[model samples]
Target: MKQRCVKPRFWVVLVGTLGLAVGCGKAPSPRFDSNLMVMDKYDISFEQQQDIANALAALFGTPDDPYVPKESGLDKDKIKLAAGPTKSDKAGVHTGLYREHCAHCHGISGNGMGPTAAFLKPYPRDYREGWFKFKSTERAEMPTNADLERILRHGIPGTSMPAFEVALVQPEIEALVEYVKYLSLRGMVEIELARQTSEELGEGERLPTTAEFLVEGVLKPQAEKWSSAETKLMPVAAPPADFGSPASIAAGKSLFYDVNKANCLKCHGTTALGDGVLNDYDQWNKDVAEFRTKADATLASLTEQRGKAEEDFATAVEALGADSALSEEERKQQRETLEKDKAATLKKLGEKERMLPTAMAYTLVPRYIEPRNLRMGVYRGGRRPLDVYYRIHSGINGTPMPAIANLVADSELPADLSEEEKAQRRQSLQTQRMWNIVDYVLSLPYEPGGELGADISMLGRERN
Candidate 1:
């Protein structure tokens, strides 16, 4: 199977199909301008929008007169226009749970640009992109149905996304998941159709079979992704003996900073400050080169000021004459080499300025993400050793952190080993190294200056 690499540009394909055309027939839905839509970028005019909208209407119908994909294998019972808990008093009175809880942030169309999105710091995730940040699946794979349900149940710890398990019943949560997928699929189809239409227009032609193409190209592929998501999980073997011993941690620490191995120091920094550089972008800030440029300029300006200060100090010492320990000529010479003898105190101040918050803004939008400072002992994922293992084995799905164990290769295997045996041996070696990494990471926060040379116990026991 050919692997699909999702481009960030694809995530920006916005859909404006709210069934409004520009009349009082129904109020025009407010347009989302923060994101770039395919229709706008491809110069898809009002006529083109209507053409695609009409084609979609013929296939999916309008909100007032909906067209459900019952024939396409979608469960009729699960498909719904609304989702939420029952209104109470009546035993079977179900209200729009999604609207009541999620719409304000997630938006009515699941575009992720709700009215309140402006006030949020990280901003609500635009689901139209279909790029979920957290998942158990491998990189670039769509999250499984269970993954979505888990998020809805557990909620993201650091964001405005709340846990719905306490507020809604299991059935309600399941229904909402269906609705979310439905909206997501609808948005994807809208973008796909727009893209197909744009291509046809470029060639001075028309799509041969709009409906059939949509069914095969957009609907089937996305549904298959949902179905196959659970299958992409990275397998793990049982941990090596004495996995949490001090020796294991020592080995793990070696691997963590090993330039040829884990290479964690490249991003996590030597002191675990999340300041490592790759292509001038660290985990916390994009386009870090821009910030570094400004810091450098600031340092240059401070250096010039320090030169004047040195001249002033020399003059003051010269006036002291016999009262001072040095002669006037000695004082003048010492001032010229202020930075030679002792530490260049001025450069130290400049470095301190780089660590300040004001100097770290890398982009116009306040987007800032730093690599995890392991020493803080704050992990969004659970604090158990197993959680760290899962992160190492699978990697954070949408971040720079990679599946470290998956990239390792065991060199001494038999030349003609069977595929099964090879897989078993690989898993064994990978799991052993991963356990070492987990042990070392768990020891990070307690290690002074993020040093891992000390013999220490794993911070938490493995759940597995």
Candidate 2:
């Protein structure tokens, strides 16, 4: 395991105060340079590192010189900080509410690696990736502001996160949402800069170390995307007249298992226990194997490239001039252990001759997300009827969950063949189907053994 080091911010202050001179006044101080800072594992150059740091600081601000949003939605000046349990007038709703409520578990930086994060099961969400699990938008899109507010108000079930509905008012919740978005954008920009630096460094090209370019080229586009999340909203159509009826539930059950339709059983499993096919991967994980073919030949090529990169990463870490408490032998041993783990992973990959059929797979990249256990009755998206309706209509962004509404067009053809007639008929069918699915999903936990429709009959009867 890699050793975790707490950064020595005091040394940075001391040496920075000393005018960037340290060690008998002969050596140049590496305190201010993020690349030489002990926490940096990538070991980027001083100038580029400083530029990245400055860009982050300009957007997010430091713990002391905090950036308060004025035009980005929330009225910073109007925010009033709550002192203890004291109550203020309706107009003087608490400010710095996010810092007070969320910073402990989510961190001041909103990196999700807060002090209490270590103790939690299914760690606090790292918003830096700019991907939200529950939203009304399509895949790979930023969530609408309502999505964030709803999560804050209701909180996630069977998780450490708590609801702020009773504690915080409308304004406070709005402010927190805006602040979370700001942090998310700031982190994404930093990631973009790091990625750009790594690509250039790998190709032996000159790095773009300008903070202005970082803001203009990376941050602006993401900010605009965030601002436009509402535009991508999938409006939930009015449910059919017989919505939530027994017939609707029965129809929904049929659709759930239909191979070409909802087909929810593929990933959600026969029991909806999230124990379906084991070959699921999220958006990020999928990216790791982008160059992979259907066959296993790519494994050998990847292993070779991995070996070279492992050596380079080890060399870079060893060459770092940052302060460390570990002896040379300890660091060397850790590097060796990591290389061994990489080899093991590559060997496991080579064991599989062909990749699973894409149709049977959850087809996303990056982190692999487990299908939600429907029987648990724990919806990360709001559990309100409309919330479930929206999720069924729009699907969770950045996951295998797809919008049932969009799939209606391909499921059946309308009596009228005209384009306009088809669209109207499709929308009508989509709304009814979505409502029925929501009814069935919501009833799962209440059924015997959490079974639904025909599956309920499969439960063993007591034999006398």
Highest-lDDT candidate = 2
Pairs in clash, predicted candidate 1 = 83-97, 84-97, 284-369, 284-370, 375-445
Taking the tens digit of each residue's C-alpha lDDT, what string does model 1 give over 1-464?
Answer: 65445432222222332233443344432322221244543445444555565555544443223355653344435554344332443666565666677778887667665768767755665566456656666666767677778788987765677788898788778767776766665566667667777775553355444556767765677666655767886565677887889999898888888888888888777755555653333232343344455555655677676676567656654565545677778766865565342234454444334432332321234354556666666565556676677778767754577768453555656769998999878767768888998998887766663244223234321100
Measured on C-alpha atoms, candidate 1 has an lDDT of 0.60
- Candidate 1, superposed: residue stretches over 4 Å from native: 1-36, 40-45, 55-67, 71-76, 81-92, 200-202, 207-210, 277-368, 384-386, 405-424, 448-464
Model 2, span 199-237: residue lDDT tens:
655533554546456556666766777888888876777
Tell me the whole-model lDDT of each prediction, alpha carbons only.
Answer: 0.60, 0.60
lDDT of 2 at 25: 29
Sliding window of 10 residues with minimal summed lDDT for model 2: 32-41
